[model samples]
Target: MSPSTYRQYEGVKARRRWITVGLVLLAAAFAIRSAQFGNPLIHVDENFYLLVGDRMLHGALPYVDIWDRKPIGLFVLFAGIRLLGGDGIVQYQVVATLFAAATAFVVARIAAPMAGRIAATVAGIVYLLLLGLVGGSGGQAPVFYNLFVAGAALATLTALTRPERNAWDVRRQGAIAMGLIGLALQVKYTAVFEGLFMGLALMWASWRTSRSPARLAVDMALWIGLALAPTLAAMAWYAAIGHLDAFLYANFLSIGDRSGAEAKELTRRLAKAWKALHIPLFAVMLAALLEPWKRWERGPATFGFALAWLGAAIAGYAVFGTYFDHYALPLFAPLAVTCAPLFTYRPYRFGLVAASLMVLSGAIANAVIVRKSQLKRGHQAEMTAMVNAIRPRLKGCLYVWNGDPLLYHLTGSCLPTRHPFAGHLNLLREHGAVGVDQETEVRRILAGRPSVIVDHEPTPRDFNFAVVAIVKAELKRAYRPVKIVPLKGSRLVVYERVEPK
Candidate 1:
């Protein structure tokens, strides 16, 4: 009640808040460690990212020397890791845990206003636990990008709602939010849709306070441009190097060029993800919409904001249409935020308890599934052994005819072609001289006279017919098959060059 007593109370509260952050971070490390430290290499995409990063650190350029659809910032992140020189995937996992913990801390802060401290703490832990449920546990783009998105969302929420703050303060917070969103976009373009949602929400807040249509339009335009600057900067960098068309084609047109799965297959994937994560997802969603409605008075706009944010996130993922389980990660933060109602509204306390148990248990279950799918399946070890066997014999570039980008990283050889993952050159999906161009590239790679090559035999339906023909013919003329290594589902053949081109 007195000034001295109140100051002491505030200091104690601050210390307690820091302690909670520490504990939640420990939980994050444990969650990611338990999920993937056992096998670690569940998905090849993460390794593909590392391969590009490693190449860039060695003075090779991305989109020119190494190729993928990943945006520039993702490459910079892994490139920094490669430069730092931590041993293998373990370093990546540790970084991912730190990001996860940071995200959890952000979620807690964002929710603290609506739900009490206890509920906010629960939200942080729940978000960390749910990260393990997705198929891409560690090193996934979402694992890193979600932290930025959550931070952006939190900053925007504060900008709009903190009535005590002056307009200049709110504007500063708005800039911070937009800046975070810009960074998130460079990590993954999927952040664009979520950025749109946050922008609309902030504009609504601006209009509410000022009630000026012209100002809202002008201000929103300025902020939107600022947020999109990273993407534009990337385009300019590539353009300056005369590869702007390459950047545009890779980031924009390449995905559209691929043939999508049939509706039936997409439906199956959607159903499986829904069954795995949606029990908790739906419970929280139902509670959020209905619980506030039953309140004698209309619930606060924060509740509505949570619902809309969750909807936008879900829609952001769904618009892509193919549901890899990790794509479900963005849904959890907003879901966690909205589910704070379970703690506040007595009627839905059961939702909190039920969802918490599901998420925590599912984390373990997902880990086991990944281990079985990758480790028990047995090819990863075999592939590693093959690369180890051939690493000594190869002197220059190593080409994996129909395999993953990780070949270069594991074997310690440079990639002969920027299109290291030969699947992209397959005849079925890509059009517009893709087939002709790839055949020419393959022959060009062969002309370099690499000491070693590894590839698999592709059936008619399996690969590009022309590329496969070129490979077979080139081997017969200039190279000899030295060893055939057996894997679980297929075989890998290593070729040694016998004669010059």
Candidate 2:
């Protein structure tokens, strides 16, 4: 107990804190760099939204002109890019990086109040690492949505810890949290689950301390109402135009019904979920679940709330129940928060470190896979060149097969992109799957009488290639394949419909 011994002990503890912080910083640096090092803005979904946004730039409605189930915010945000300048890949990455940094800060803020400063720093770094692993490049909306969700969680945590504050403080914090939730919903409705959960958690924490049901109910109503107001206003506005049908029927109902697609069986869905977590993360989640129970007074509230949030997010995923890996993005916040406690205990710190290393390793592996995949195909660049070459040649209409984003990005136009596999909509129905209306749909597509068809080669064995095949078949029947040329490291097959010229 001598002064010298005490001083030595303090020094060791300080070093441990610095070391952890240093490691966390290293992880953040890796995440930022990883985002900058990826492919161009030609991802499948990115192309779809880029095209939609390009159309909106010209005052074309999404559902009325093209087709998709994405929320309006997604389109509007992209549309803003077209508004300000153009839809270049670099612009998309810039916005993505900014939003991602904000999300990391939110995680740190949420964890700082619950755990110490060091732990909070580590949680933020962990989130950034996980985000780098999952969020691909080029203006992906989900990345921004994830950032908003994290911000909401941080606001809720602040409200919970400060429940004894004056009315103004509670109202301000509660309202901020509620508004974040609403904004999250505006980005993606799946965000609604996490938003509502956080809102309720904040209200319950305030209620537990005050012991007045009336006070609790009123405060809860106020926050929830304010939070949801933006989303309601957006819906009302979109509804005023005939576009409401597209918003509700296509986005909400059609997307919800996509679960029954043959590719979305429950077994496959659960399996993909497991793969996404991997063994190490699964362990972290288990540790997080158990850690709360051990803390007794603090453990019950914090861990129980985490469990509720985790369960709700999982249930939301099950509802969509598609075998897609991105469905798990909404769960990342709870997963990261709940798993953070594992780092506090010394023994668990080793596991936490191990898990982080595994995540880092996985990121490196993914980057390698991305490189290899790109080397295997030259079609994307070739397709881009083909579109550019054909741009001046066609006058009537240009319909892109496979709905490539480069088409719109290069052409500076928002025209319909035909799908070859749309005929499968009928097949999906024969199998009793709920799908988009293809009967009226096919006729609507041909109505454009596209003067040219740009068909990119398909990814080997992807079901989406069915659409590509359908386009090729229809083109072969009506038009002769004029020339199959190679450009920009890939092949482009151009078909010009025969006319009595």
Candidate number with greatest lDDT:
1
TM-score quality measure for candidate 2: 0.79
For candidate 1, what is the lDDT? 0.72
Q: Which stretches of model 2 miss by more than 4 angstroms?
A: 1-38, 163-168, 241-243, 256-259, 263-270, 289-304, 347-352, 372-383, 417-436, 456-472, 480-494
| Candidate 1: Cα lDDT at 132 | 66
Residue pairs with clashing backbones, model 2: 420-471, 421-467
What candidate 1 gets wrong by more than 4 Å, as runs, is 1-8, 11-15, 38-40, 213-218, 289-299, 343-352, 376-383, 431-436, 446-450, 455-501
Q: What overall lDDT, based on C-alpha atoms, would model 2 receive against the true structure?
A: 0.60
lDDT of each: 0.72, 0.60
Candidate 1 clashing pairs, residues 3+ apart or interchain: none
Q: For residues 1-501, what per-residue lDDT tens digits would candidate 1 score against the true structure?
A: 999999999999988886877686567556555546523345667778888887787788877777678799998998877765654566676677788788877777776666656666776777776766665466788878888999989888877777676555556667778888999999998988888988887777777766777867766877788798999999999999899988887788778766666678688778867865675576576666657324423235566666788889989989998787778888878877766656555655664666566556756666676656564333446566667667877978887776556777878887787777666665444533332377678788888987887775434363567777887888888888777766446566788888755
